[model samples]
Target: MNVAPNNHKTGKEADTASVANYRVDNFTRLVTYSPRFLLMLLILPVLSGLVSVLLPAFGWAPALEQTRFGVQGFMALWQTPGLTQMIGLSVTSGFISTLLAFLMTLMILAAFFNSVWLNRIERLFSPILVIPHAAAAIAVGFLIAPSGMFSRLISPWLSNWELAPQGILPHDAYGISIILGLTLKEMPFLLLMALGVLAQPELGKKLRQQHKVALNLGYYPMTAFFKVVLPNLYPLLRLPLFAILAYASASVEIPLILGPNTPPTLAVAIVQWFNDVDLNLRIKASAGAVLQLVLTAGLLVLWLAGEKLVKVLCNNSITNGRRKYHDKVWQTATIGLTIVILGFVLLALIGLFLWSVAGYWRFPATLPEQFVLLHFQNSFMQMSTPLFNTLTIGFITTLFAITLTLLCLESEQLTTKAISPFTHLIIYLPLIVPSIAFLFGLVWLQQLLNNQTAFLNVAFTHLLFVLPYTFLSLSSSYRRLDPRFANVAASLGATPSKIFFQVKLPQLFAPILIAVALGLAVSFGQYLPTLLAGGGRIATITTEAVTLANGASRRTSAVYAMIQMVLPLIGFALAWILPKYWFKGAKA
Candidate 1:
């Protein structure tokens, strides 16, 4: 009997060990396959959104009871007055702004690279990067409009008259004001992206060495950069530039404030169609959205063609061996222009702050005659709903984005296989496609699901955008993580999961926090997605600020814009500080 009892105990121990081993194997497989699963999850909604838009364009949406395909929707869109102008504006503004922003980014970097001013310039632009596009446009309008602050300051004195000059650029029919707004906003982004690209230490050193060789071979500094460094740099920046091109083309808020209204940019027009009281206009809006997508794609193709042509021209120039170009003049001009742009941006922001406090200042005066707290006091109560919605939506979306992004990134690191190029393109699709196009489709989708809560729907839509940017911001840091630390922990008998939680995440606390902050900023600044997906039921600070900009209430508008700008600033400030607090010895 004793021998039989001992045999039973040994059998139970063996069974338990077998089960545990199976579970461990399952988990390892899960970690290895997580990226593909996550990517499929991200792609499904986008594909559905696109299909939903395309169906309506073809006059076949079940929600509106158009069960058969027809071209009626497209017919209506084409027949609309000023459609040509709208597309033209969208195209020109996108291409021109992107071109200028790209050039300015290269020039400024060339001028400041390895200089004492390099770090300082980057830090100074941090706040500029945080400023909301709507707020910037509003502030720019306040300064440059016909009866604007600039006129208030210099008016008749500079003009040798007693009245203000007609605003030359503020709402010019050619969309000049819109271009300026886009260029200013996009420059910081391009610069940030370029700086990120240059982060690899060895790559940086190699480029510097190549630059020296060219200089020694009698190549001008700028020429050497254009010939030697640019070939490598452009490929890295292509994704960001394409994103800029897409954004510039389809932007809603900035163009609405600064662009001409005869036929506003295609994005603005499409938005108006959806917003129209007549619900059938939504079909037309969907059609317009499809056209906008086509237009954007065309512009991208053109950009690629332009790249080829430019490359051929550059090769010829390099072959001619013109080594004595005027690089000093180019450098000085670039630095001077960048400084002026920054100065104007600073002044525009100050104007927003000042207007928020002004009591009743008349035009043609440099400063406010009397400042008061009335605007702030009046705004405090009315701003509650929008502010609440903004906070709730921002938090939820940022949480979702950060969680998903971390999972996919961690899985990629743990996996033996490399993440594919196609996966990278999927990550960028949202940034490249016009939001005005996909967001309306999302609206119809919500209706089909009978989704009533604006807050949830809006947050989900924001997540689509927030994820791409969050992923981009955190990716480089995550990939470049030194594996030696984890290897050391493993040698000490730590399991992979334990090492990841204990060693990897703690070391990466700073980047993780920074990514969250950037995601929050992206979510906070979103206007179109919030406006459309929320169906006007949900209001955020951005929607309110843009609405306020439409009227003659300068002080109240300024208060709203100031409020809009402040939220992101608060998020970024926390990002900058909390990383140091958590990881005391780690760099933020």
Candidate 2:
């Protein structure tokens, strides 16, 4: 009787274990087949940061002893002296910069959409994508400053001057310098985005053929491009356009270096208030942050309105059936202007290189009279710690971000449900939102959580910022991957894990490296996150460059800026070369 009862209990326990194992396997399948949980995890930080800003905008920062909610912060913010001028500067620079970038992008596509010029333009512009916005701004500043290389080269030859002509080139009063600086930096990004849009297989060949058909129907090249191709293109470009608008409106480092002092751009002013020694100004800064969001939204609305106006204008041109306008002239004009822009960028970077080694260099001389390694040696020693910290943070954040993105994308592949538009918005939220509005809140959250590891804290913050870009960079190749490769592996009885590691990952190695390089660039370019999360206890090449720009030591600043350029270049080079070598060896 005892043996019979024991056997019965053992059978019952075995059944229970079997059920538990089934449940566990089912849960694993559910997670692997959906990205719902991952989406929530990614969106949580963005939501938290918004809430943190919203409360303080109403004067409710309890830590600062202002526990009450009111509109005092907003009142103070609007009442700031020269507030209207500041808003105008922000709007004008943002608008003009975005408009120019958009028009230039359209013209390039119109004129050179499928030609050799287009191919060469893309190849040349690819490297510009890796140049950080801050570095580009610094480079432009060096090139255009009153005492800068351009003036130095022209001096005594064309113009007789022993001293730099002040109030002439950079940091001018009307913010033209800022506008120009922003346009140069933004053009490459918009062009890159346009290339991606135009390069889509469905759009690529079909659109070119459509343009040719329209041209054959008595439409000019620019006219045909507008009537035949651009309507399809604009819809795709809307999000990236909004991103540029937001960035130009809330830009900090660029405006700081190139904007006016008497009334700096609104973003710069807000940063100043946030960093003010008086704790009460933090509320003002918060109010300003909210205003920045509103300002960016307003600019986007205006752009949308302009789109409607352009539609009407283009409709008139397209239907009027007049075919004799000089499309070649427009093409030539755009090409010349683009060449000028590229020339400026090249000269600017070369100016930085020249300045870094310059010693006892006086005004009115094109080349340095004396060159030395002193700046490099000194910068090397001073930046060693920060350099290591930057590398460590970049490595940690990129590794985790790439892994997370891969998992989410892989889940999408496994599921029938496609990643939704709302999910794309989640990925773009960090880029759309100004860093000032939420980064401080992030700093507060970090302190509250007692996350004292500065490196980890900063790396995590960077991961949030970097993940969206990494996903964008990699998602295209990932989603478009040929399913037949996996199908073949499965036919050979390969498990899902083995197929992923052995087949998909190897095939995607190039895009993976490219995504990593993009992430590394994005992290290196971060300023506000590093400043707030690291609590000024950490420094990187970017922060050092921006800080050094405030001082008059051009040599020191150049050294830091050049160093910032090098790390990303190495990443880009590897991304470019590795795949070729790997495939070459595979054939061998």
Candidate 3:
């Protein structure tokens, strides 16, 4: 070896050694420079939250007196009466709302697939999609309650005489009102998702061409839609469907406002148990959380099965139908449903605005008896701190989520092999799993770290929910980007950073803005993460609305709900306006 190492080596051998060294350095840099590795850095806080929350769920939390594992807490959960009923309510509401939303979405798409009204309907849907679930529930609660504005409007004429407000709709024993409220809130979401799918110019053009061919063969538009187009659209629409299922199943705030109190939905019940001042009851809450998780998983499987069945049936009918029914019944039905949904949305907002300004709005009164601005004034004065806190959290979370997502997209683009499926699994797990389970884990980690920095922890927790959606929205556009420009720029001696800034960034500006707006809306709507991670120290508009809703105080809740609804709409408008003006010099 010593004899060979003397400077007697050939030039060709030296060249081979240099090449091998360069290859090693390149491999090391590639591994170290991955976006997934960068993503891990962003997720450190969430990992801590998950661990913290899990400790308490097990019997490991010292905050509770459970020094050892036992079946005592789970036994208490089983012994609780009406627990079965609560779980049933959660399942029923979740299934029904998702089913109705899907049906309504399909009908609307069948009617307005490429019609003149499509754009108008899409514009209307944007604001509705931004309305927080809690705000929508509270607003619906105010409008449909026994002494609500609807009752007041017809009580004198239809019910006759006016002094007795006996038949009330809010808190109905059957949960019909809850189902209706959830449907109203969820339908717009489904519609938005459908619109996004339909907006794909290539897909739209292909579907339209197919429709024309079918029409020339004497088939009706609805028939063509049900037969030829819907199958293509269903796959694109599944993500939103899963989102609706998850929200409906584990939602706490909406159920608190509209679900039956005697045996509230499982989520509300779990929250009650967790908040029980007794340490032992927390174990029962943990058990209930586990039960909720099981129920959600079961429902998801059922949904997938049902979707498959529907697709098969629809495909069969498309091949078998012999008659041309040009009745446009679907169009009429869709228009009617849209009108009713919009009417309810308008009535809710109007009622909230009126209640916020009323000094006295007693039952059986169509309008407030006396008008005063004091309620609005008071709400604003008290809400300043929470509003600031929410804005700060939302801005930071949105920025962080967008940045992380962009990096991930860049990395995936650079690599040829598919990234880990677990990346998506981890991101979407938060969306489908009960928030309580994840929040519990986060709390345990917080305790272990003994880091009392609540705001940072809370924002990081919100990012867990927000990041998945932001990435999903951005990934499509990012993948669709043409790589030729980057290659050409590189050949021209441009650096990677400069190419991204000068070429890729400009093209993605619109989708990025939309992603940010969507992220802001998600952050604004968070309830459980904010409450649990903030330790009640951070109150967003959602938290304020939920607290007032618990008391069923129409005036204050209405005011807070209005603010919650408005802030997101503003974000959406910016999403639309900023891109249009910046890119095309016109309004979207």
Candidate maximizing lDDT: 1
In order of listing, the candidates' clash counts read: 1, 0, 10
lDDT of each: 0.84, 0.83, 0.78
C-alpha RMSD for every candidate: 3.4, 4.8, 6.2
lDDT of candidate 3 over 17-125, digit per residue (tens): 6776676556435543656664564455545545554445556667665577656666787889988888788889889988998998888777776577878887887
Candidate 3: pairs in clash: 49-442, 50-441, 52-441, 52-444, 52-445, 53-440, 53-441, 53-442, 53-444, 54-441
Ranking by TM-score: 1, 2, 3
Return the TM-score for candidate 2, rounded to 2 decimals: 0.93
Candidate 3 residue runs with Cα over 4 Å from true position: 1-67, 311-315, 323-327, 416-426, 482-484, 584-588
Looking at candidate 1, the ten consecutive residues that score lowest on lDDT are 1-10
Give the distance in Å from residue 242's predicted Cα in candidate 2 to where it truly belongs: 0.5
TM-score of model 3 (CA atoms): 0.88
Q: Is candidate 1 or candidate 3 better by TM-score?
A: 1
lDDT tens digits, residue span 292-361, model 2 = 8788888888988988998887777766778757888897898898788788888999998998999988
Ranking by lDDT: 1, 2, 3
Badly placed stretches (over 4 Å) of model 1 are 1-30, 585-588
